[model samples]
Target: MRRSRLTLTLALGLLVVLAGCLGPLQTTPSATDRSTDGTTLSTTGTGSVDAEADLAVVSVAVVATAQSADDARGQVASDVERMRTALREANIPDDAVTTSSFAVYPEYDYSDGERTERGYRAVHSFRIETDPARAGEVVDVAVGNGASEVQGVSFTLSDETRAELRAQAIERAVTAARADADAMAGAAGLSITSIETMSTSGGFAPVERFDVAESAAGGDARTTFEPGPVSVSVTVQVTYRAA
Candidate 1:
């Protein structure tokens, strides 16, 4: 019996030695055992779509200067009233016409070693918005009646119109990006296996890039108003996994 017990103890010792030799098996990679050959690449693509402008905005400033503050203000007040009347007669709503600026300021001239008060300057500016169809008429009245100055004219999207344009623009951008991908693949002698990832942005419609420079030069010819179109554009970036 003692000999049997000695044999069992030796067997147990051998099993313990085997466990120590194996230690713990690693299932995850360590810092030193990392792969350096992996690569992540990026590329960008652009798309553009053009559409005609659908809306217009214009700024008109009427300036009148006189020797006295009351005179300057009174002239501006009279001009404003006539301007409103002209707009109303031209079929523009009072609500559509808004006052943007109304102020009276003093002007001075320093000459002959003395300072002299030139006069008081009063100016009133208005921003007018209306349908594009009859925009020409509105401008005509402003020039013909009391508004002698056209600060600027711009084309833009209304709230509802802008939202619609944004979606259409994105669609066009995506289509363009895919077309570019196909072209690239063809050039590389490879067909598009499949798109792994697609990201896009840009292409907004009816841009307002075209500026309408005011021609106060037409001082005598009724200001010869011209309501021109404007262009607005947006940029988009697209990233796709090159198959």
Candidate 2:
């Protein structure tokens, strides 16, 4: 009995000594913890590049209504062919004109809470890409042929142009971020030691307005189109360590 008690006392003493050696729990610091360590500054800078749009996309649609679905579809097909011919005459290649949507559905007429089937309506929509200078002419040709509706026109930069602009915008953004950090550090009487983290995001091209009425009324007059400049913006968030 005495040996057992002595053994228990020794075990308790050893556990106390081990606890003291271990001290307290040690945890790995997280990203949030490091960011709020009171020794880092975070700032965001934005930059933009203005570039002329090189391509134009015209949205056009043809619609026809008839007593039968087949009849409506046939009429739509004919109109679509004529529109294609017009586009071809305007020098728009076959590959540049793409059929976006085609549908045929029954029309409904509601009067005095009574529903009646009026007729079948068919619709065919096309997307045409061409030079910005010739966008107005393309629209006129399509409208004069058989296209009943002009859905709006939009302009955009080509892939190569977009890439080039993106690079320039990012470079400007980084420079702006560095300048901002330097200014803040100088005002606070602190010096930037190193860059901790950086992140960037890109902006989209703005839509330019295209007047459908002007194009329709052009007649023999030259249809003028202006694809205004589009701005490509880039924003950068940078975190710097202060000393």
Clashing pairs in 2: none
The residue-by-residue lDDT of candidate 1 on 1-243, one tens digit each, is: 999999999999999999998998868888888854322223354434344456666678778889999999899888888988989887788888898988899999999988899999988999898766555556678877788687766656677766676666666666766777677766776655545555554434332233234556674433223334433344445444443
Per-residue lDDT for 44-153 in model 2, tens only? 98889998888889999999999999999999999999999878887899999999999999999999999999999999999999988888888888989999998878
Pick the lDDT winner.
Answer: 2
What local lDDT score does residue 61 receive in model 2, on the 0 to 100 scale?
Answer: 94
| CA lDDT, candidate 1, residue 223 | 25
RMSD of each: 6.0, 6.5
For each candidate, what TM-score against the reference?
0.68, 0.79
For model 1 the TM-score comes to 0.68
Instruction: Quote the lDDT for 33 in model 2.
Output: 80
lDDT (CA) for every model shown? 0.67, 0.88
How does model 1 fare in lDDT? 0.67
